[model samples]
Each structure stands twice: as C-alpha cells, then as structure tokens.
Target: MRIIRAAKVLTGRQGEVIVDGEVLVDGSEIVSVGPRGSAGEAAEVVELPGHTVLPGLVDAHVHLGFDAKVDPVTRRSPESERHLLLRMAENARKLVSAGVTTARDLGARGFLDLALRDAIEEGLAVGPHIVAATRPITLTGGHCWYMGGEADDERAIRRVARENLRAGADCLKVMASGGMMTPGAAPSWVAQYTTEQLRAVVEEAEVRGKGVAAHAHAHAAIRSAVEAGVTTIEHCTFFTPSGHRFDAELADVVATSGTYVCPTVHGVMWRAREVYGPEMLDDWLRGIASMREAGLRLIAGTDSGFGAAGVDNPTDGFVASLEVFAQAGYGNAEIIELATVLAADACGVGEVTGTLAAGKWADLIAVAGDPLERLADLRNLALVLVSGRSVTQAGVDTVTASVG
Candidate 1:
C-alpha cells in the first residue's frame, strides 16, 4: 500500500477539490481518497507539500502511426512495418511523459496500433493504456487510403469492420468525410459515405459491443453520422465548398442525440489565421462556443499527429487545446474535466479510470502548482502514476513494492 499526499487533489470530478488530501493505493487500484491523514497506514508515503494531484489526462484522438512532421504522409510511403512500429513505440512513450495515461489511437496502418498496444500491456514497451481503432474504414481511394481500409459498399464496410474487431480493436473508426492529410482525395467538405453506409458500420460494431467513431468534417457527413448513431464525431467541422459554416439545427440534433464531439482544437488550428485569414479563425472559435451553448458534449482531443505545433513534445499542445476551450468560454475546472473524466467517458473507459476514486486504476499525476489556478501548471509534472506504478517522477524516489 502507498499514500500519495498532496496539498490539493482534484478528483477529476467537476468542482470536487480536496485540500490537503491523500490517495491510498493498493496494487493497481485506488483504495481511498479523502482529506489528509484520513488514509490509514501504508508501506510508504509520497508527499508533495506544494503540489496538486489530479487524474492523468486522456487524449481521445491520436494517430500513433503518423510521424508528426510537415508531411507525415508522403515521407512514410516507403517505411517497413518494423520501422513504423518502432516509431510508434517512441511516440507512445512521448505521450506518457507528457502525462497522458490513456490515449485512443484513432487511426493507424496495418493494425500496428494493436500490436503496439499489446506490447505495452505485456510490459515489452512503455506507454499509456491504449484504446486502438485498427485500420479505419474508408471509401475506396478516400482519405487515408494508404492505411489499407477501403470499401466501396456496405458489404465491404462490414467485412473490413469485422476484420478490425476480430483483430482485437477496441472500437471502430470510419472516415465519413474526406480530410486534409490525404492529397488528391476528396476534400474536407465532401461527404464520402451515405447515412446507410455509416449506419451499417455502426450496427455491426454495436452487435459486437463496441462503439463506432466517425471522422466527419462535412456538414452532410456530420448530420449523417449523427443520424446513424455513432459513439463520437471527430473534427465536427461544418465545412462547405467555399469555407466553414455552423448549422444550429444540426448542432441541436447532435446535442439532443448525446453524441460527443472531439473538436481536435490544438495549436495547429491557429495556423488557419495564416491560410484562411484571422476572421476564419475567429469564426472557428465562435463555432466552438456555439456548440457549448447548444449543449453539445465536447471532449478534448489534440489530434496530435496531424501537425500539432510542437507535436514532438505534446504537453504544450495538449494544454493549448484546453486553452482554446478557455477561449471558447470554459472555466479551468470544466476544461480539466474535458481532458480527464469527460474524455474517459467518451472513450468508454469511465468505469475503470478517469476519476481518482476507490476501485479505479490509480492513474494520476502530481504537478508543482495548482492547475486550477494556472492551467500551465500541468506542464510541470512532478510525478506520473499509471495503474499505481510510477512511470516517471522528479524529486521522488524510484517507488517499487509488492502488495501487503
């Protein structure tokens, strides 16, 4: 048993902050969390007098296979599978060091994300708990066609979905619309799949007890995905032929259906000011604010591998994504919830992790200052505990012990 004592503890529950709190851990599960000195005897106690402890962050959307470079796609045309796996392992570790204890790999090639996930679980590699969507479903020669998942019709979509699920995919990912990464493919405003096709994928995953994540950018694609009942919508940008637009009726429908939206609001979004003018960037921010007004369930997802500024070191980008929510008029506590509890819920891991509660995995982090006041404090990670093991720590001993 061990006690992680901190000056403050944000249990990842909105508005629940315990001052002078202690979290008791027995093996990989949290035993209790309460005011300081309430947690009883333990084999060892790690104390942080000026720190704030919170649940480890969850990045709901990421692409572990793509190297976060200027052109992550074109450069990877000739790499072997072995080399890609090695690179993915390194990226996973980078995510861990940035305090992401749980991350969902939204897309990958050759089911390599599954292989990397299994390797991490077996202790052969170091990384956070991974929820992988192996080989995203796409239209023939559509976006991300190089990843080998391309289907022209519903039957082919079901076949590809079955293949990924059989290979131990935690969820299904469908490219409902085109995206920016692929060149000469359908543009972002183009809807690639029909409502019936997306519904087919959703129904297939539902029978298997898994949810489908739809990569929808076009307004039509977003509406179809909502009507088809996808678990989450990635990059829910209402793209048009000329520029972006926000449809309130569609937003209300999405909000009513209880579909979570991962806006992928990271540092790279600011680059829109250079390409599309400052007014467009301002409109983008306004759209995010409107989603909140419409009661849309928004979760934090950095889309880290897709040219996030400082993607190599993702801590800044992760926090910057949250900062965008702040710009959208969210409070610090609410933004924190988006990255922790809310993110975990959207990814279907709420029961096992997310909050710092008893019977949950002890996935938490301690920072030098209070993130509640200064969100940037998250970058100053003093210790990170993933399932009760100290993966990385500063100013603390190499804590190791057996259950007693």
Candidate 2:
C-alpha cells in the first residue's frame, strides 16, 4: 500500500477540495482519499508539503504520429513505419512526464498509435494511457487524405469504419470538413461530407460500441455533425467565410443532445491577433463565451501535433488552453474541470480515471502550489502517477517505482 500526502487535493469532481489531503493506493487502484491519517499506516508514505495534488490531466484531442513541425504531413509521409513508431514512443514519454496520464489520439497513420497503446499497456513502454482512433475517415481528396482513410460513399465509409474496429480502434474520427493544413482541400467552413454520410459513420461506430469524433470547423459542418449524433465535435469553431459565426440553434441542439465540444483552442493571442486582427480575435472569444452561456459542454483539447504554435507539449498546451478560458472569464475551478474530469468524460474514460475516488485508477499529479489560486501552478508539477505507478519525480522521468 502507498499513501501520498499533500497540502491540498482537488478531487476533480463537483469542485471538491481537501486540505491536508492524503490518497491511499493499493496496486493500480485508489483505496481511499481523505484528510491525513485517514489511511492509518501504509507500507510507503510520500509527503508533498507546500503542494497540491489532483487527477492526472487528460488531452482529448491529439495526433501522435504528427511530430508538431511546420508541414508535419509531408514530414511524416517519408518516414518508415518503424521510425515513426519510435518517434511516437518518445512523444508518449514527453506527455506522461508533463503530467498527462491519459490522451485520446484523434488521428494517426498506419495504426501506429494503437501499437503504442498496446506497448504501454503491456509495460513495454512508459507513457500515457492512449485511446487511439487508428486512422481518421476522410473524404476523397479531403483533409488528411494522405493518411489513407479517404472514403467518399456510404459503403466506403462503413468499410473503413469496420477496418478501424478490426484494428482495435478505441474511437472513430471523421473529417466532416476541410482543414487549414491540407492544401487545395475544401475551405474550413465548407462541408466535405453530406449529413447522411456522416450519420452512416456515426451509426456504424455506435453499433460496434465505439464513439465517433467529427472534425468540424465550419458552421454547416458543425450542424451536420450535431445532426449526425457524433460523440464529440472536434474544432467546433462555427466558422464562416466572412468571419466567425455562432449558430445559436445548432449550439442549443448540441447542448440538448449531450454532445461534447472540443474547440481546439491553442495559440498565442498576440500572434493570432497579428494574423486575424484584434476584432476577429475578440469575436472568436465572444463566440466561445456564448457557447458556454448556452449550456454547451466544452472540453479542453490542444490538437497537439505538427508543431503548432502553442501546442508544443500535451500538458503545456492544455494548461495554455485553461489560461485562455480564464482570460475569457471562466473561473479557475471550471477551467480545471475542462482538462481533468470533463476531458476524461469526453474521451469516454471517466469512470476509470478522472477523479481521486475509491476504486478508480491512481492517476494523479502533484504540483508545487494551489491551481485554484493560479492556474499556472500546474506547470510546476512535482510528481506524476499513472495507474498507481510513479512515472516522474521532480519534473523528470524516472524508473517506475512500485509502492508496495
């Protein structure tokens, strides 16, 4: 048995906080959590004075295969599968070291992410628990077509979905609209697939007990994805050719349907302002705020890959997203939930890993200060525990240690 004592603990559910908290772990699961001394005596006890402990963070949207570089698609194609696998393993370590215990990889080529997932599960590698999509279903010549998931018709879509399931995909990602990264593809605001086509993909995934994540940015695409009943809407920008547009009716439908939305917000404000101008950035922020006001369930996602500006690291990008929400007037508690409990729920793993509750996986992190007071304190992570195994100590990767 192991007991981790901290000055404060954020339960990551219902905004609960425990002072002088202690969490007891037996094997890979949490035995109990409460004030200090609640666990009585343990075989091993680690004290973290002047620190706050909370559930390990989850990044709901990521592409493990893309190496976060300018033009990552082209850079990724030539690499051999073996090379790509090795690179992904390194990326996984980076994520776990930064206090990200769970991650949902929305897209990857050649099913490489699944191999990494299995490796981590089998203890062959030290990394975050990965929920991989395998290969994203895209349209003919649509965004990310080079990954070889292009499907134009219903039959093709169903076939691809089945193939992914056979390949052990945890979820299905369908590109409902074009993307900024793909040249000559449809505009971000243009729908790549019809509503019926998207529905087919969603139906197939749901029938097989898998969730579907739709890559939607345009207003029309967002509406179609909502109508298709996708589990989560990725990049729900509600964008238009003219500028940012928020469709209230569609947003209401999404809220009513209990669909989670990942806005994919991870960029510096000043840099964005330089490109889109201050007025456009303000409108974008207002749109996000309006969605929250309309009862939309928003989760944090960095779209961390391809060396994007603010998404250099999974944990760092997520923290930056929380800061963005904070700047947009979201309270610290609410902002933290977006990356912790809310993100885990969005990725379909809430019961197993989101909170510091009994019977849950002991996946949590300890930081130097209270995150509620300053969200940036999360960057000062002291230790990371995944599945009750210590993966990092004092901001560095260390050999996994058994508590008992």
Candidate 3:
C-alpha cells in the first residue's frame, strides 16, 4: 500500500477539488481519496507539499506509427516491421513519461498498434493504456490508403470491420472524407464513403461490442457520420471548397446526438500561424468556441506524429492542445476535464481510469504549482504514476514494470 499526499487534488469528476489531498493505493487500484490526514499510515508515503495532483491525462487521438518527421510515409517505407515496432515502443514510452496515462491510437500500419498494446499489457514494454484502432478503413486511393485498409462498398466495409475485430482491435476507425496527408486523394471537403456504407461499418462494429471512430473533415461527411451513429468524430473541421466553414444547425445536431468531438489541436502555435495566418487562425478558434456554445463535448487530442516535430515529446504537443483550448476561452477546470475525465469517457475507459476515485486505477500526476492559476503549470510535472507505479519524476523518464 502507498499514500500520495499533495497540496491539492483534482478528482476529475463533477469539478471536485480537495485541499491537502491524499490518495491511497493498494496495488494498482486506488483505495481512497480525501484529506491528507484521512489516509492512515501505509507501507510507502510520497509527499508533495507545494504541488497539485490530478488524474493522468488521456489523449483521444494519436498515431503511434508516425515519426513526426518531414515525410513520415517515406521515412517508414524502408524500415522493417521490427524497426517500426521499436520506434512505436519508444513513442509509447514518451507518451507515458509526459503524464498521458491513456491514449487512443487512431491509425497505424500492419496491425502493429495491436502488438504494441498487447506487449505493454504483458509487461514487456512501458506505455500508456492504448485503445488501438489498428488500421483506418478508407476508400481506394483515399486518405491513408497505403496502410492497406481500403474498402469502397458496404460489403467490403463490413468485411474489413470484422477482420479488424477478429485481429483484436479495440475499435474501428473509418475515413469518411479525404485527408491532408495523401497526395492526389480527394480533397478534405469531399466525402469518400456513402452514408449507407458508413452505417454498415458502424453497425458491424457495434454488433461485435466495439465502437467506431469516424475521421470527418467536410460538413457533409460530418453529418453523415453523426447520422451513422459513430462513437466519436475526429477532426470535424467543416472544410469547404474555399476554406473552413461552420454550420450551426449541423453543429446543434451533433451536440444533441451525444457524439464526442476531437479537434486534434496541436500545440505548435507558430507553425499554425505561419500556415493559416492570423485571421484564419482566429476563424478556427471561433469555430471551436461555437462548438462549445452548441454544447458539443470536446476532448483534447493532438494529431501527434503526422508532421509536427517534437509532438511525441512528453511535454510539448499535448500541453499545447490544452493551451490552445485556454486561449480559445475555456476555463481551467473545463480544460482539465477535457484532458482527463472527458477524454477517458470519449475513449470508453471512464470506469477504469480518468479520475482520482476509489476502485479506479491509481493513474495520476503531480505538478509543481496549481494548474487552475496558470495552465502552463501542467508542463512542470513533478511525478507521473500509471497504475500506481512511478514512471517519471520531474520531467525525467524512469523505467518501471508495465502494469496492464
């Protein structure tokens, strides 16, 4: 048994915060959480007098196979499967060290993400609890087609979904529209799959007790995905032929449909400003604000590994997404919820993790200062614990046994 004493603790539920908080852990599960003195003496006690403790973060979208280089596809083409697995293990360690105790990997090649997830669960590697999608289903010559999950018609879509489930995929990821990565593919504003085809995929996944995540960028595709009853929507950018557009009616429908949205906001502000310009960036921010106003459930996710260098680093891209949410007018509590409890719920792990609650996994992080006062304090992580084991301390990584 261990007791973690901190100055403050955010439970990540109902906006609860305990002063001079103490969390009790028995093995990998949390036993209790309350005031410091409430927890009796234990075999081990870790105290932080000036730090705030919170649940470990959950990133709703990520790509473990991506290397975050200039040309990730070309960089990965020549590597053997063994080398690719090695890189993925390294990336997963980086994510865990950065306080991301749980992450949903939306895309990967050759079902490597599944192998990595199992390896971590089997205590062979240290990493976040991964909800892996295996390979994203797409159309012929569509976005991310090189990963080899291409299905055009309803029958093919059902077949692919079944195959992924048989291979032990945690969920299904379907590309409803084109993407920015593949050259000569359909534009982001165009839909790649019909509504019936998408429904087939969703129904098939649901029957197998698996959720479906849809990658949609266009307004039409977003509506189709919402109507198809996908578990979540990724990168709901609402792109048009000219640029980005926001449809309030559609947004209202999405909000009412109980669908979660992952904007996949990256922390690289300078690069975004350079590419989209100030006015355009402001427009994007406004769109996010509008989503919030429409009562849409937004979660924090960095499309890490697609192109932003250093995104896979422990403290860079993930924190940047929170910072972006703050700059867009989210309160400290709301932003924290998006990363912790909300993110976990979106990824379908709410009961197991995401909060400093009894019977849940003792996955949490302690920061030097109060994040409510300044969001940047999150970057000053003092210690990261996943499944009651300390994997990082004061921004440095430490090797620990993998706890499934």
Candidate 4:
C-alpha cells in the first residue's frame, strides 16, 4: 500500500479539480483518492507539496518502434530493425518519465511493438503499457505501404487482419487514404479504400474481438470508415477533390457512432516548418478546429514514428496536443480529456484505466503544479506509477529492477 500526497488532484472529470488531495494505491488497483493528509494510514507515504495528481495520461496514437527525425522509412534498411527497437524502448522510457502511462501505437512494422509490449508487461523493460497495431493494412503502393502491407482486395485485407491478430496485435490499423508522410501520394483527397473493403476490415477485426484504427485523412475515406464501424480514424480531416476542405458527413457519423478521432498533433511538423519551410502544415489547424466544432469524439495522438511526422519521442506529442487544444479555444478540462478519458476510451481500455476512480488500475501521474493552468506544467512531472508500481520519480528518470 502507498499514499501519494499532492497539492491538487485532477480527477480527469471535466471541470473537477480538488486542492490538497491524494491518492492511495494497493497492488494493481487504486484504493482511494481524496484530500491529502486525509487518506488514512498506509505502508509508505510521500509528500508532493507543489504537485498535482492526475490520472496518468493516455496517448491514443503513437509509433513506438520508428524514429521521426528523418524519412524514417527511407532511412531504414531492414538491417536496423533491432537497433531501432532498442532506441524505441529508450524513447518509451522518456515517455514514461513524462507521465504517459498508457499509449496506443497507430502502426509499426513487423512485431517490434508486440515485443516491446511484452517486455514492458513482463517487467523486462520500463515503459508505458502499449496497445500495439503491429502493422496496418494498406492498398498496394498506397500511404505507408513501405511497412510491407500490400492489400488491394477484401480477401487480402481479411488475411492481413487475421495475421495481425495472430501476432498478438491489440488492434488493426488500415491506411484508408493518402497522408503527408507518404510523399508523391494523392493528398488526403482520393479515397483508396472502398466502403466494402473498409467494412470487411472492421468486420474481421470485430469477429476476432479486436478493434480497428484507420489512418484516414480524406473526407470520403473518413465517411467510408465511419459507415464501416472503424473504432478510430487517424486524421479525420476532410480533404476533397481540388483540395477543398471540410469535414462533411463524416463528422455526424462519428458523433453518432462514437468513433474516436486522433489528430496525432505534434509540434515537430510546425517546428520543422519554421526551420525547414512552410511548404506543409497547411490546413492542419483548419482541419482540427473543424473536427472539434462538429462534435466529433477527439482523442490525442502524437503519431510518433520514423520520418516526416514524429521524432520517435512520445512526450513531445502529449504536450503539443494539449497546446493545440488550447489554441482551438478548449478549456483545460476538455483538453485533458482528449488525452486521458477520451484517449483511453479510444484504446478500449476505458473500463480498466483512464479515471482515477476506484476499481480502476492504479495508473497515475503526479506533477509539481496544476496541469490545467500551464499545459507545459506536465513537464514538471515528479512521479509515475503504473499498475501500482513506481516507474519514474524525481531525480531518478530511469530504473532497472533491483535484485534482492
């Protein structure tokens, strides 16, 4: 049993912030969460005077096994897979230090994420719990095809979905349209997935009791995805013929279906544009704001991977997405929800995690100040506890288990 004292507790419920609160964790479950000093006796106790306790962040979209600094895929020569996985494990450690206790990978090559997931689960590594999408299915030569998915027909998609499940994938990812990372491809406009194929992918995953995450940027593909019962849409941008942009019918469909929309917003792209050139980043803000206004269920994702988007760093995206929400006129609570409650819900781990409510897993984070005041305050992270075990704490950023 352990008691974590905090200056305030952000219960992750909208507009709910309690000052001078605390949380008690025993084993892998949260025993109680309430006012600090009020939590009765415990085996161990610590004080975080200036810190705030929050439900550990849930990053809905991430790429664990890829680097985002360069054209990650192009830089990979098939021989560096092992090295890349090791580096990704290090990145996952950084993410855990930043208080991200749970993350869902949007896509990755082979079973790198699966291996990493097992490592973390089996106490062989220190990192966030991962709901990995081993490899996403894509049409031949379509977006992210470099990951080696060459499905162009319903049969192929079904086969790939089953293969991913057999590989212990927690979800199935499908590239339903073109994206910026895949250069020279159709710009988020041309839909690469037919409605029937999309349905097939979702149905197959459903029969196996798995979920589907669609990397859909175009409006047509987004609509097709919503109609087909996709669990989450990666971009959810409405790109039309002739580059006309608007979220169209997909918004209402998602609102009705309760599908999650992961913008995967990271500062790397915009920051890179400032250093590299404003050639891209166009319509990104517009797409995000439009989705927000449409009442779409928005979840946070960093799309951390090798190449054009992420730097393989998960913490960067977690903070960056909060800033994006702030810029879009969202309050602090709503912004937090995009990454926590909503995101965990997106990953199908809502019941087991997300809220600090009792009976849920003891996945929690503590910061030096209220995260709602300064989105960057999350960087003041002090302690991270996942499944009632401490992962990161002030001064000690990384931990290798001690042998008794």
Candidate 5:
C-alpha cells in the first residue's frame, strides 16, 4: 500500500476535485481517494510540496505501429515485422513517460500492436496500457491507403474486421474519409465513405464486441459514420472544397448517439495556421467551437506519429491544446474537461480508469502549476504513476526525474 499527498488532487472527473488531498493505493487499485489526511497512516507516503495531482492522461487516438519518421507510413516504405515490434515498444515508453498511462491505438500494421499490448500486460517490457486496433479497412487509393487493407464491399469489410479480431484486436478502425498523409488523396474534410460501407463496418464491429473509430475528416463522411453507430470519430477536421461549416444535424446526432468525438485537436491546432496561412484560421476555430458548443464528447490526441508540430511530450501537447481552446475563449472548466474527464469518458473506459475514485486504477500525474489558472502548468508534469507504481517523478524542486 502507498499514499501520495499533494496540495491538490484534480480527480480528472468533472466538477469533483480537491485541494490538499491524499490518495491511497493497494496493489494496482486506488483503494481510497479523498481529502488530505483521510488515510490515517500507510506503508509509504509521498508528499507533493505544492503540485497538483490528476488521473494519468489518455490519448484516445494514436498509431504505435508507425515510427515518427520523416515520411508518414501510408506513403513510405513498408516496415519489417521485427522493426514494427521494436518501434512499438519505444513509442509506448515515451507515452508512459509523458504520463499517458492509457492510450487507444487507432491503427497499426499487421499484428504488432496486439502483440505489444499483450507484452505490456505480461510485463515483458516497460509501457503504458495499450488498447490496440488492428489494421483498418480502407478503399484503394483512399486515406491511409497503405496501412488500410483495401476492401470495397460489405463482405470484404466484414471479413477484414473478423480477421482483425482474430489477430487479437481490442477495437476496430476504419478509414471513413480521406486524410492528409496520402498525397493525391482528399483533404481532411473531403468525403470518402459510402453510407452502406460505414454501416457494414459498424455492424460487423458490433458483432465482434469491438468498438469502432471512424477516421472522418469531411462532414458527409462524419455524418454517415455517426449514423452508422461508430463508437468514436477521429480527426473530425470539418474540411470542404471551398471551406467548412458545422453539420448541425450531425453534431446533434453525435451528442444524441453518445459517440466519442476525438478531434485529436492538438494536430490541427498546431499545423493548420502554419500550413494554410492566417485566412482560414477563423474557419478552423469556429468549427471546433461549434463541436464544443454542441456538447460532443471530445478527447485529446496529438496524432504524434504524423510529424505533428510544436511539441514532443504528449502531456505537454495536451496542455497546449487546452491553452489553444482557452485562447479561443472557451470557459476554463470546459477546456480542462476536454483533456481530463471528457477524454477518459470518450475512450469508453471511464468507470475503471478516468477518475481518482475508489476501486479505480491509480493512474495519476502531478504537476507544479494549477492548470485551472494557467493551462501551461499541465505541461510541466512533475510525477506520474501507473497502477499505483511510480513511472516518473518530479524532485522536490520540481524537475522530472530521469528514467535511467
């Protein structure tokens, strides 16, 4: 058993946090979490002089199979099986060190991610918890054409889903729209999927008891995916030929269907301004604002392997995302929720992992500043724990302890 006391414990739940709190962990579960001094005495106790603690962050969308190399996977040389395994382990460690204890891998090649997931669970290597999706189904010459196994018909998509399930996938991924990674492909907001195909993929995924993430960029594809019952929508970029606008009806449906909208906002918020120039910045901001206003379930994802600019640490990326939202004039509380409680909830593992509740896993992180005041505090993470075991720590003076 262990106890960690801190000046603040942001439970990562919406509206139920505390200042000067203590958390008790036994084995891998969070036995008790409450105000300071709640647990009389413990086997071990660590004090956070003035830092804040919160549940370990979750990146709802990632791709461990691809190394963050120069050319994106969908456009480059194929990775050797051995290389994929090795790279997956390295990516997981970086994520864990960033205080991202639980990550949902949206897509990965072959069966590498599945194997890595098992290895992490078995303690064969150092890594965070992995929720992996096997190879996704895609249309030929479509988004992520390489990693995606091209399948045009319902039978083909269903067949691919079953094969992925057989490969030990925890979830199913489908390329529902064109993506930026593939040259000559449609932009983030161009339509890519037929309503029938999305429906088929969703139905097959349901039958296998696996969740689906529709990689949607355009509104037409996004609407079709939501209507088809996807568990989450990735990179909802709101792109169109001329420009873009919110699909209000689709937004309402997503809010109504309880689907997760993982904007992976960090990627767009960082790149679009530099890539497209300033004229389209307002368009990008408005679309995101609309999604937030409609109360969609948004989560944080850096699209790390995509050469996503501006930051390195996933935790820092998450914090920067909140700041962008704040700068855009969102309420501080709402912006905070997008990275914490909302992110966990959107990933479909809220009950067991998101908050600092009794019986949940003790996945927590501590930082020196108050995120509620200046979002940058979140970037300066001090300590991180996964399953009650310390993965990284900040010294008394507030610097990350070296891994070695």
Candidate 6:
C-alpha cells in the first residue's frame, strides 16, 4: 500500500481539482483519492509539499520505429529488424521518462511495436503502456508504404486488417491520404483510399472490437474518415496543392460525428514553423481553433519519432504540444485533459487509466509546481508513476519519494 500526498491533485475528471489531497494506491490500482487525510495511513507515504499530482500524460500518435533526427524513410528502408527494435526500446524509455504513461504507436513496421509492448510487460524493457497498431494499411505506393502494409483492394485490406488483429494489434491504422514524409508518393492532399475502402477497414476493426485511426491530411479524406466512423483522425490538416484550406462545414460535420482529431502539433511550433512557413502555420492554427469552436474534440500527439523538425526531443516534444494548445487559447485545465483523459480515451484505454479515481491504474505524475496555474510546471517532473511503479528522470526504478 502507498499514499502520495501533494499540494494539489488534478483528478483528470472533467477538470476536477483536489486541494491538499492524498491518493491511496494498492498494488497497481488506485484505491482512493481525497483530502489529505481521507486516504488514511498506508505502508508508505510520499509527501510533496510544493508540488501537484496529476494523471500521467498520454500521446495518441507516435511511430516508435522512426528516428526523429533522421529521415524516417531513408533511416528505416535498409535497417535490420533487430536494430530497429532496439532503437524503439530506447525511444520507449525516453517517452516513459518524460511522463507519458500511455502511448499509442499509430504506425510501425513489422509489428515491432507489439514486441516492444510485450517486452515492457514482461519487464525486459521499460516503456509506457503501448497500444500497438502493428502495421498501418496503406496503398501500394501510398504514404508509409515502406512499412509493408499496402493493400490495393478491399479483399487485400480485409486480409491485412485481420492479419494485424490476429497478430495482437489493439487497433488498426489506415492511410486515407498521402503524407508529407513519403517522397514521390501521393501528396498530402491527395485521397489515397476511397470511402468504401476506408469503411471496409473501419468495419473490420469495429466487428473485432477495435477502432480505426485514419491518417487524413486532406479535406476529402477527413470527410471520408468521418463517414466511415473512424475513432480518431490523425493529422486532420486540410492540405491542398498551394497550401491549406480549412472547411467550416466539414469541420462541423466532424464535430457532429464525435471523432477526435490528433493534429500531431508536437515539434511543429519549434521545427515546422520554419519549414512550413509562418503563413501556413498560422492557417493551421486558425483551423484548429475553429474546429475547437465547432465542438471538435482534440487530443495531444507529438508525432514523436516520425523524424523532421518537431521531433528533435521526443521527451520534451509531448509537453511542447500542450504549449501549442495554450497558444491556441485552450485553458490550462482543458489542455491538461487533452494530454490525459481525452488522449487516453482517444487511444481506447480511458476505462483503465487516465484519471485519479478508485479502481483506476495509478498512472500519475508529480511535478515541481501546480501545472494548472502554470503549464510549464509540467516540464519539471518530480516523479512519474506508471501503474504504481516509479520511473524517475534517469529512467531508473525507484520507490515513490518526496522532492524537497
């Protein structure tokens, strides 16, 4: 039994906050959470007098196989599977150390993500609880075709989807449009798959009690994904030949469908602004704000390990995403939810974790100060607990303890 007493506890339950609270944890599950003494005595008590404890963060979209510093396509094209898996294990450690308790590997090659997930579970490796999408379904020459998940027809799509599910994939990731990273492939605004094809993938996942995550960067692709009932839309950017085009009507349609959008803005503000230019970046932000106003649910995903500007620092990239939301006019509470409960729900694991509630996993973090008051406090992580096990700054195991 263990108790963590802190100056504030953001329950990750619809912006609820507990002042001077304590969380009782038994084994891997949280037993109770309330005012300081409400949890009573425990075998161990971790006191953080000037800190705040909140749900450990979630990153909805990540590609563990890709190295952020190198060109993903070039880096992985000839790399051995063993080498890629080892690099992925290292990436996972960095992610967990940065306070990301749950991460959904949106895309990966050869089901390496699944192996990494199993490794973490078996104590062979250290990483966040991973929701693996073994390999993303794409067109023969579509985006990320190198991942070896290309299906040219409906039959092939169904076959690949079933194969992935059979291989223990928790979800299915489908390429609905082209991407910026894959050169000579379809452009980002081009629709790679038809509505029927997208629907086929979604149907396969739904019947198997899984969800489909569509990689859509064009307006038409976004519409198709919404119509096909995808759980979340990755990089929901309305790209065009010239630049981006935000469609208000389509945004409203997406909002009505209750589909979550993962803009993957992590590293964008820092690295992409120069690459994408300020004008295009401004347009993207405006579209995001408009979508928020239209009731579209947005979740935080840094696109970590996907290579390029925004991903130089995978650990800090997750927190950088929250800053993007803040700049977009999101309140601190709302931003926190985007990274915690909302993100967990988007990744299909909200029931087990995401909040500081009884019966939930003890996946929370203690920071140097109240993040609710100043978002940057999140960067100053004092301790991170994933399922009641503590992982510190150095990625070393430790018992939960106070931070001065």
Best by TM-score: 6
All candidates' lDDT scores? 0.86, 0.84, 0.85, 0.78, 0.74, 0.87
| Model 3 pairs in collision | none
Error of 6 at 284 (Å): 1.6
Model 6 regions more than 4 Å off? 75-77, 308-315, 394-404
* Tens-digit lDDT track of model 6 for 176-201: 99998887789999998899999999
Query: What value does the lDDT take at residue 9 in candidate 3?
Result: 90
Candidate 1 RMSD to the correct structure: 4.1
Tens digits of per-residue lDDT for model 5, 280-359: 66676677788878887777776666654332323224455556677566765566566666767666677778788899
Model 3, 391: alpha-carbon shift in Å? Answer: 0.3
Q: TM per model? A: 0.94, 0.93, 0.94, 0.91, 0.89, 0.95
- lDDT top scorer: 6
Measured with C-alpha atoms, the lDDT of residue 347 in candidate 1 is 89
Candidate 2: 10-residue stretch with minimal lDDT: 395-404
> Candidate 4 clash total?
4
Please count the clashing residue pairs in each candidate, in the order shown: 0, 4, 0, 4, 2, 1
* Backbone collision tally, model 2: 4
lDDT of 3: 0.85
TM-score ranking of the models: 6, 3, 1, 2, 4, 5
Question: Residue 242, candidate 4: how far off, in angstroms?
Answer: 5.1
- Per residue, candidate 4 scores C-alpha lDDT tens digits across 193-268 of 9989999989988987878999887878888898899899887667665553764565777788888888777646
Q: How many residue pairs of model 1 clash at the backbone?
A: 0
